[model samples]
Target: MNTNEYPTHRLVKSEDLNHHGTLYAGRSAEWFVESGFVAASSILNPKNIICLKIHGMQFRTPVKPGECICYTSKTVYAGKSSLAVYVKVARVSNLESIIVDGFITFVHVDEHTKACPHGIVIKPETEEEKLFYKRASELGR
Candidate 1:
């Protein structure tokens, strides 16, 4: 496990695949963003946070029916009013084979939907953490 990262599972079915018989990019993206939203909401009020940027979602494998995908998400960086979450999706059968990965940036907002500081800080302890935090910070610019 990576810090407070959590696993979210989704079963592959007919509706999730594209015409070419592989998982649809659109569907994968939906889950990616949803996982990031869940990560942010776990720390802040769900109503107080909204997605700002996706950074990027890189698809690395093709998934077919009968395969279960696991999405692992964690808040990697907290800056002022923005929080960045890193997510990795892979099949449950092969944990080492990553199907997709990305970083998503979210902003904390007030009741009026304006950006507000969350006053939280995350100290990157290991090299991996530092790398993710660095990449997340780049999305701000």
Candidate 2:
């Protein structure tokens, strides 16, 4: 997938810093997974998807309260009913990048059986998608 094809969302009340201050890691994680789901669903079957797991996530900088946190996500690869999504969280103001990023993986399963089918349905539709596929491949996913 190309970089532009990645899905992105701005800050909302649900995504906020914890009582201890700074961004809540759990909220950030939830946003990341949700972003992943959005990206994957856009490419494949939206109704049948579920977040299977978060592979690796590292916070380089803390997102503070009232800051506009931006989450960008894209599908890196598709296998049958499953797709690996990579998400990046950053603080943006006047369009400046404040943080780097991380990733999450989601799977598409049968609504009833919850079993993953076997075949990539969403092929790269644009240059951005192709680029994401390349990047995901480089990461060994």
Q: What is each predicted model's overall lDDT from 0 to 1?
A: 0.89, 0.67
The residue pairs that clash in candidate 2, if any, are: 1-128, 1-129, 1-130, 1-132, 1-133, 2-128, 2-129, 80-119
* Deviating ranges (above 4 Å) for candidate 1: 1-3
Clashing pairs in 1: none
Instruction: Write candidate 1's Cα lDDT for 90-124 as tens digits.
Output: 99999888988989989999999999999879888
Worst 10 residues of 1 by lDDT: 1-10
TM-score per prediction, in order, is 0.94, 0.73
lDDT of 2 by residue, 1-141 (tens): 332345465563533767777777887777778777777777667777777778668877767666776777766776655677877777666345636465566666786848577466446777866776666555443
Candidate 1 steric clashes? 0
Model 1, residue 86: distance off in Å is: 0.2
Reference-based TM-score, model 2? 0.73
